[model samples]
Target: MKTFLLNSALLALTLSLSAVGGPTASPALAAEPTPAAPVAVPTVDVDPALWVVKDADTTIYLFGTVHILKPGMGWFDEAVKTAFDKSDRLVLEMVEPGAGEAQQLFAKYGLDQNGKTLSSKMTEDEKALFTKAMEKVGLPAAAFEPFDPWAAAVTMQVMGLQKGGYDVSSGVETQLTAAAKATKKPILGVETMESQLAIFDTLSQETQVKFLVEASKVVDDMNSSMDAMVALWAKPDPDGLARVMNEGLTDPKLYSALLTNRNANWAAWINEQMKKPGTTFMAVGAGHLSGTTSVPKLLTAYGIDAERVAY
Candidate 1:
């Protein structure tokens, strides 16, 4: 359940929320911005895991990323940068929508116009838990009344991240997308933003409410888990990352919808890309590139092997 954002690609929504406005998009995160870190911090060289799939002419680099981070993470230097610089094209999980479009999409799918308020979906105990967490973040009990459960859940997580000083502008995708645009590199998406939103929109109400309840339990301090996840990623230990991110992701149906199915789709996409002749750097959430149902493992079933790129 916790892996939904880590593995299911809902992390993109956090960035989308920021793009539409700022963290203040949710009243929970309406605090003054923290001062930027000093410019002369020591660089901590991190070798995040990278892999490659190559044939005679085509080379595809598969790099895993933490969606958001505190600024000053010196991860873009080493082999990760070299692979990105050498690539002719950049492929991301989805090409994010612009601010106006994202705002419209959220209104269309994230709002609960036809249903009772998100709090109504909760049991008395559940509502108590969620309301308590909301109060902790200085949000009124009805602050999330207009949102669907999925939206409420995502907003809680995003607001927590903002409060913890995780900058969306420092996110790996944001950085890479800007660089790709600057160099005139053709940026592509394996899926569309609409399709990604549809995944959450199509979820069963039970699952949506369940996800919301889980999110509320730790809403005020969401970064503790992420800090641990980033530490593992900075160590370049994909196996360790899998252990942390994939933990408690046990529901079979949600598991398939979140991880295995998307990985299979990405493998098929890569197989088709192999038919062409160009270097492509594919960056996605680290959770997707780790775990037993990782993209590389699925690629193997398609007879394409992804080897680790030694730094």
Candidate 2:
């Protein structure tokens, strides 16, 4: 079977990068415990997208987010703010753990203690590609010696972007989370940290390495690809965003794990959230809201009346 680039998909689709810090770890994903350095507030404003699902008593606002961005986007205002301000609670893909806890969790599943190296799973050709990628991100070959392929893939993909100046602190969810905390509004997550890790861990080793190789191939294009995706997102063009993000999603289990099944679960969760009387602001990665397997598309099957909120 052919492999697709799932590393970018993991960043684009799941927004699952956690605190995997070390001198060698990707800066954007490393150091989750540390408070983010203050961002240079951008004067250039942008209108990303959002949707509204409602009935007489319950209203849920669904927004798509980019998990990392270059440090100059002014996104958390206009319609996005109105919806969030009116919301009773904020729902995210997952609530991240703090400090050593997130690092411990990532290492627990992503590392090999018995000294099985990540490159040992690859062919000579694949190893050559992976080695070059590690070097491109300014990490040594031995830095990933203990990495599982998925972990290496995660590190390489995000590190490539971070090296290009994308900061996790500048991501959509990061700022929203900070604001939500300041206001003391309740925040909830659709998945747990352990469960998100298991999605990658349970993949067949072959699949994991396949994606790792995919990461190696695309690491050079990371900035350009993300620039295009973010451009589409700023236009609030879900179709264009879908076209870019969902491209090369050929691996069946990866497609299911990263988008389809998770989206279905989210739709089901949104449907259930409608049972009680309250407003919810549901924010997830743009990939989850823009595709055919998007939460809005699935919500339609459940007879949940979801409409584009014209801002």
- Highest lDDT scorer: 1
Model 1 C-alpha lDDT per residue in residues 1-311, reported as the tens digit of each score: 45227422355664555544433235432332444663554657778899999999999999998777777788887788899999999999888766667667766677775857877788999999988876665556676777788877776676567667676667788899999999999999998767777777878889888877877876644787878788889888999988876664655666777778888999999999999999999998888899889999889887999999998
Q: Write the per-residue lDDT of candidate 2 for residues 13-95, one digit (tens) a residue.
A: 22333433442333434433444566565556778888999999999999988878777788788899999999989998888
Q: Candidate 2 overall Cα lDDT vs. reference?
A: 0.76
lDDT of 2 at 56: 93
lDDT of each: 0.76, 0.76
CA RMSD, predictions in order: 2.8, 4.1
Off by over 4 Å in 2: 1-42
Poorest 10 consecutive residues by lDDT, candidate 1: 23-32
Q: After superposing candidate 1, which stretches have Cα over 4 Å from the reference?
A: 1-41
Candidate 2: clashing pairs of residues: none
